[model samples]
Target chain A: MNQQNILFTNNTAQAIDTAINNIRPNGIFVLTDKNTAVDVWPQVKAESTMMSEATLITINPGDTNKDLKSATLIWENLINGGATRHSAMICLGGGMITDIGGFTASTFKRGIKFINMPTTLLSAVDAAVGGKTGINFNGLKNEIGVFSPASHVIISTRFFNTLQKRELLSGYAEMLKHGLIDSAATFHKLIDSDPLEIDAGHMLELLKASVEIKRRIVNDDPYEQGIRRALNLGHTAGHALESLAMKKGKPVPHGYAVAWGCIIELILSHTHCGFPTNTLRNAAQYIFSHYGTPDINCSDYQDLLEFMHHDKKNISSECINFTMLSNVGRINIDRTATESEIKTALDIFRDLAGA
Target chain B: MNQQNILFTNNTAQAIDTAINNIRPNGIFVLTDKNTAVDVWPQVKAESTMMSEATLITINPGDTNKDLKSATLIWENLINGGATRHSAMICLGGGMITDIGGFTASTFKRGIKFINMPTTLLSAVDAAVGGKTGINFNGLKNEIGVFSPASHVIISTRFFNTLQKRELLSGYAEMLKHGLIDSAATFHKLIDSDPLEIDAGHMLELLKASVEIKRRIVNDDPYEQGIRRALNLGHTAGHALESLAMKKGKPVPHGYAVAWGCIIELILSHTHCGFPTNTLRNAAQYIFSHYGTPDINCSDYQDLLEFMHHDKKNISSECINFTMLSNVGRINIDRTATESEIKTALDIFRDLAGA
Candidate 1:
């Protein structure tokens, strides 16, 4: 917890100003992907002074590059830029950038400090709040990492204006999860919003609500020992789908994959956790109608199942999941759904989404 | 803390049997150096059931070889061998193997369990016991690492029977440090032992004492918050000298560099901490008479000092060191020694050691 203030602002310029004035890091190493450097750095540079102490380093964008090679390149950039143990790194892109940059800062000389200025809607709400940083190794996602918090996380809403509609739709899925896990009020707010019409202020508020829900859960169980597992309500299937997408090079945006997985997990919850059948079906239909559906093929079912078994969340060779109950704002982390039930749920989602 | 029933046995065959029956790791990965694999693997193969596990991965040894490349190779081995998250690795060579192997284990899939069965005397006493594991990157020693305890640590003395005399002497320097810090009995034992006549039993006892001393210090401050800086006693100059040696491709064994650094630090302590002049002079003379003198050129002094200034240990730009007084069992950490006094102490050691 070396970070002083975890601040959120709608203006990127103000966020940068607060970071420079409040943190006054020994030096600033702004980390971004090539796409982000192209799309975001102009806004970042326009807001901040070119101090003698700061240097900028850019990584390539996208999940394919979010592996050990990228982390190594980032480390090299830091060293070549004369970054020391006291230097602070600013991760300024999507989840992939944050994951790689945060881990580089955490491991450089045992550790340094870092800040997250997540641009993607998914990352703004999830990756920025959690201290989880990592790089994939050998086909396994997040196989190498440490759970070290950044000094501060600055969430700015300016980037939302530039986000693709599809990405925003994908990100809203997690907002729904926050409601299903602990807050009916937040859920209703999300349901009431015109996803297409939402402005930066509304987006920031949703981000805050979503982050607050996560922070409370993590505060009680930072290391995922028990209660924090509740946060993974849809992630058991979500990660498997993401892994399959990644391996095939189809590469679904992480949030979209999670949204698809949530539909399946909800159906399974109805069977195993005694969730109301209509409530689960309605939620599944809502998500599928909004985010479209994952292109899961019958031919790839076994491969998906294999990926599920290999999910880091699984224990004792079982495709264990943190399924939910019927009530909105309540979930069960300890529930396990059978393989056949999981297949049935996925099949139902495919039929419901007509995919 | 995860590790239990750690053993430092005297027989290699017995150590393997002990690991098999006692620890019962899910899978076995025997880490060996090129030297050990060529000379000792034949005997090791005849003695242990390494192939009983899913696979065996052979890696070249040495500090240069301990890098991201080797980590990748090990990862490939694990994947090919079907090593699950439960799999554990057993490092069976010197300090370099343990550092790299432990780092690989600690980082793969966030982490897996591993054991240290240090073969070299230098590793048996120092590297094996500490939870610190890392690999050098971009010419920086231990540039990337994590502080996670091994599943178990086994420091069998049987390996030391074949250890080169130089390596044994290097490890003995640490034994002397233990004596100087808190153990009069250990100091007496080290002083009395004839280098040629030393046996495995005596080495095991010394290793045990050193481990206990390190363990206590770590328990008080697991994450190196405060009191743990005392461990940096000889590391300031030692690290610089070692780094210089590594860059030169004629790396000095870690203990050799540290031993020389200790003599310099002791002299500086007298000038800065009101240390008795007679005690400082006598200690330098004793080491010079026993271990001969270290050879360092005047041109390298500035380079060494520059390196020390960048050491991860320094809190600020100012260099801090742990220095000792004539009272053999007492040392003061968090002491600041003047540059002139440090130069004078180095000059004195240079003259005494006939550098």
Candidate 2:
């Protein structure tokens, strides 16, 4: 039912059942957010019989709710329910649920088996392929956490039925990243995709393919010590923009920020890593046409750069770590860009993106 | 310089230099408590040329200060000091220092390389052999933690020159348990030694042998999934006694409580697993001779029982997790004691120990 601990299924509840059978836990705890508990949890239980037996624990929705308070709630529930070393926790919903749930299970009694059932399109590709678990702390995103991966990453396309067109496009940004890092063929596949059509069964195959690229990279470097940083291709600048959006009280989807950031990164790649110019231009064009531009200006540059300085991938305080590329799949990892070059990239971003 | 990641060095600072070389870190952060900063940090720096370059981060002393606030201070210091992923942290002090330091290093940026220099006798024996890193959370001991093993465990006997006789004898309790679980010969070696002197060079050899036994057991079960319960021989009852002592404002040393608990566990072994009565009596006699037993009465039995119920080893709400032995070196792990049997063991403890 599950291959390489990633289950691609039409029935997410059945996938949870498969994970239960795999672990044969003494107890089962299901964690979801308030929104997902109402919209998704009931649907999951309707499809499978055994899933209803799991003790339901819900938190609030969004990244704001994915805090220590939520983690504490989950911990208290597991303790109250008398969870044992042999018990398993099922994290349902999106990346926020999986991230915090994986963290709690990893720490409670010094870790317990956990299965991640990622409901959002973004999480299906992003959170599915890696073992990064954490929660925000001290005004930092995932500032305190560990590399505690899920025992199983169960992705069900059926859950994407609730998503809007913007949500579909958000996930597609990461899929495009998988392509740009993998091969030209995968990149071209996404550029040719219609954003309004993840409902057409084509998205399932695309997601599986996208997950394969990240899975191969994550398998090689589970701790992100070296080559595994390829997954952080666009995340450096994207994260800063995401932070800026949050601070401005106009938050955007994670993939939207990533897509915009990848454009700047592609230019950095062309300048530093000798990435081909036409490919960079074409990629940026695709992003500009599909993804809405963030309200960023030269005034925001200083703050974005400040956020980049705080990136987790950094090796030294003097420089920000950049995962650049020479061409599709020709990764030039551990690269660095000067402050001036970063400004240049931003300038190019402003001109091309018309922001 | 280091064998099996554990360095028995005459110079503690030299061992830290060895760890730095092994990791080739971009930066170094040394974490110590206030007392250690006053005493051990100077000697460590006086012996080494390069150690002064490291950023020294000190926290308040004792388990009371080993909380989230302390962990936050460490994290903030590391962040402000511009620690990178390639940086290494040195935790130099007792169990509390190593515990919180290991935890902060493990979680900060999803873990950084950390070295443990257990300056105290208790820490060298207990913290060195295991990978348990934690901080007290929400009024519970080690409620939030991870099993992040140190990159290096450096031990220097010169640092033991600062310990009181009580501290030296306190550590002897765990060393005695190590001998009991290892073999009859090891147990006899400890019972034959005097408690007045750990500086006579015999304690160093004894400490090495004790650590070897624990090292072997820990290597086999790093995560404590199975086969690691043997190491929990006395901890279950020991921790309860330790808690009771803490609550009464008459705190006993950790090893003293463990020695007392081992006596009760030995009686349970005799009742359940046919442990030799003479061997049990001799072990109990050795404990009663050196380690002072805390005052306990039948009225306090309920509190002690409740404390045991809150032990981390328990798997279900119904029964407590116990690690009993059939004989010397023949462990009967995953065993459970009924509440009545526990009471009976306590009764025997009172009769023999004059509690």
> In terms of TM-score, which candidate is strongest?
2
Measured with C-alpha atoms, the lDDT of residue A271 in candidate 2 is 87
Candidate 1, residue B199: the lDDT equals 68
Q: Which runs of model 1 end up more than 4 angstroms from their true locations?
A: A1-5, A9-25, A38-52, A183-188, A316-330, A334-344, B1-55, B183-189, B289-295, B315-329, B334-345
lDDT of 1 by residue, B1-355 (tens): 3333457665666666666666465667777777887766667677766534425567877778888888788877876665656677877788888888888887765667777778777777777766778888877778887776776777777766677878887887776666666655665676666555676676677678777777777777766656666666677877888888876668887777887777787767666666666656655665666666655777777777767766666545555545454466666766765555667777877876874
Q: Candidate 2: misplaced stretches above 4 Å?
A: A1-4, B1-4
lDDT of 1 by residue, A90-138 (tens): 8888888888888888888777778888888888778777677888777
Cα-based lDDT at residue B245, candidate 2:
80
Residue B236 lDDT, candidate 1, scale 0-100 = 82
lDDT of 2 by residue, B1-355 (tens): 0124988767666777777888898888999999999988997877777688889999999877888788889998988888867788999899899999988898888888889898878888887557888877654567678888898998767788888877788788888888878898998988988766545477777888888888888888887877778888888888888778878888777788888989989999999999999999888887887886668888888888877876777776667778898998888888998888898998998788873
Clashing pairs in 1: A3-A151, B3-B151
Against the reference, the lDDT scores of all candidates come to 0.73, 0.84
